[model samples]
Target: MANYIHVPDEAPAVPKIDVTVDERDYRSGALKLIKELRPSWKPSEVKVKFFTDGITNKLLGCYVGAVMQDVVLVRIYGNKTELLVDRENEVKSFRVLHAHRCAPRLYCTFNNGLCYEFLQGTALEPEHIRSQPVFRLIARQLAKYHAIHAHNGWVPQSDLWLKMGKYFALIPKYLKDPEQNTRLSTEVPSPQCLREELVWLQQSLSVLGSPVVLCHNDLLCKNIIYNQGAGNVKFIDYEYAGYNYQAYDIGNHFNEFAGLNEVDYSHYPDRAFQLQWLSSYLEAYKEHKGQGSEVTDGEVEVLYVQVNRFALASHFFWGLWALIQAKFSTIDFDFLG
Candidate 1:
């Protein structure tokens, strides 16, 4: 196994993308968007701070100055992310989640980015993810998200392999030449090699019986907010959200336990621990659906194993994504780190 190193909780350094907006522009944009969101709010009174967790978005933290503060996040989508994300679908996901209060309220979406309410909560750390309560909270939220019928009434992308195929096709076009690429280690697999692995993964997971649902395709820890006062968690960053295999969502989430920046694979959850966590998720899922019948251990056990297998898909998805980002993205973070 490749050795994993620990990194600090600091957000990765801002990358060198040729952005259309700057700090002043982001603050100005936030002021404009928020004024539109709350017509009574004066733009002159609005204060915008920089939200640092963003990798692919230029995020400014905006608040209406007051004792009862109304804070919202203004995200300016980075240049070239259009090469990867389906922005229309993302807008749809945010609208639905906003209605349910499971996500930040969508204030407005512009051609370049969007404005949304920023919740009061801390993002769970890598250590926090290993906690049972935190894991269960996220798992149940995933189940609830899976059950939601999009207001837009779109078709489900329950299969991730198809998306993988699409992203893979974009690889050569986006990947920078080897000489220009410094973020990736030499051990990073070639696109052809990664394709072979994805093919095998697709075939291997074809028999899993997990049902399709609308999914938050990307469930990284940084995207989840834990509201202690409400004792609830809300998911953010709908840019990559869509329908996919239920197992893939759970599996991908488990994979995120390692956290970003450090990318510590050693922290990946084990089978028994995974099952315990999954049981809570299934129980909550049944409860959400108003099913009184008990969920069988057998059912939970099956999902546990399948999610582990599906974990391979998560690695490949981001590996391909990082390779493309290394070449195409101008925001200068350590994509390989």
Candidate 2:
């Protein structure tokens, strides 16, 4: 894995508020941070709203008065998330994307969380992303996102395989709870089987020739915020953002078409739709690089194969992540199931 570097000293430092917010009593903690950010606002008047869209972290929107203007989002890291996420890399990714006008402004970091400006848009549902214009917007935005190579001379390389290895290391050999242990043994693949799959994925995908670029890594529907009025989309949550295979990012997104709550792989985009989507992405990506926008059938075909194969890696990646989450996360979700 490439060494993760902090944002260059030239880049402005993200302010550290020096206060840790308790997830259980986030109200008081969030209020203190908000008071520092919006000192003029009366504590009684500030509205602290909990956003339920996120699964990995607790998100709270704090603002004073109506219309939800000047809102600051406080994101409390999930329990034991540091074992999986590198906070330095996350903030670095956020700063890089924000510099490119591709992301919202990040306000500051706290002891156990971070605060950022709230994006005003509706979080897309599965059906919304499947429709025309919306899908195109997502593709173009993602293409632009992949175009960013702000680490100066550092050659773009993915930590996907390295992170997978780390997640596998962290995953307990067996669940502590006997009932869950029984379910883990019966329902989930044996760790040895999973290790074999990971090795297979690494061998299979390393040869696909997918360009290494900065990727969102997790592009599930809810991560996308679409502003119908502005006719644009912004991807939030940089927890998993990093240098990765371009195809893996797109393929992971395709996997997310099944929706998070009621996963159904049947909803994955058909070949025709993928071709169209990939075509849009290629054209935009090429145009961004100052290349002609015309795309060849062969070009699309090669990417299609790479992306689909990488989709398998995406599935395997998240499965391991979920198993680890099942062991440690306080959030009530059926991670093993």
Give the whole-model CA lDDT for all candidates, comma-separated: 0.73, 0.90
Maximum-TM-score candidate: 2
Tens-place lDDT digits, model 2, residues 88-184: 8899989888878888888899999899989999999999988989999999999999887646657767889999999999877788989999999
**Candidate 2 to truth, TM:** 0.97
Q: Worst lDDT window (10 residues) for model 1?
A: 1-10
Each prediction's TM-score against the native? 0.85, 0.97
Regions more than 4 Å wrong, model 1:
1-24, 66-68, 149-159, 173-185
Candidate with maximal lDDT: 2
List per-candidate RMSD values in Å: 8.5, 1.4
Clashes of 2: 0
Off by over 4 Å in 2: 1-10
Which 10-residue window in model 2 sums to the lowest lDDT? 1-10
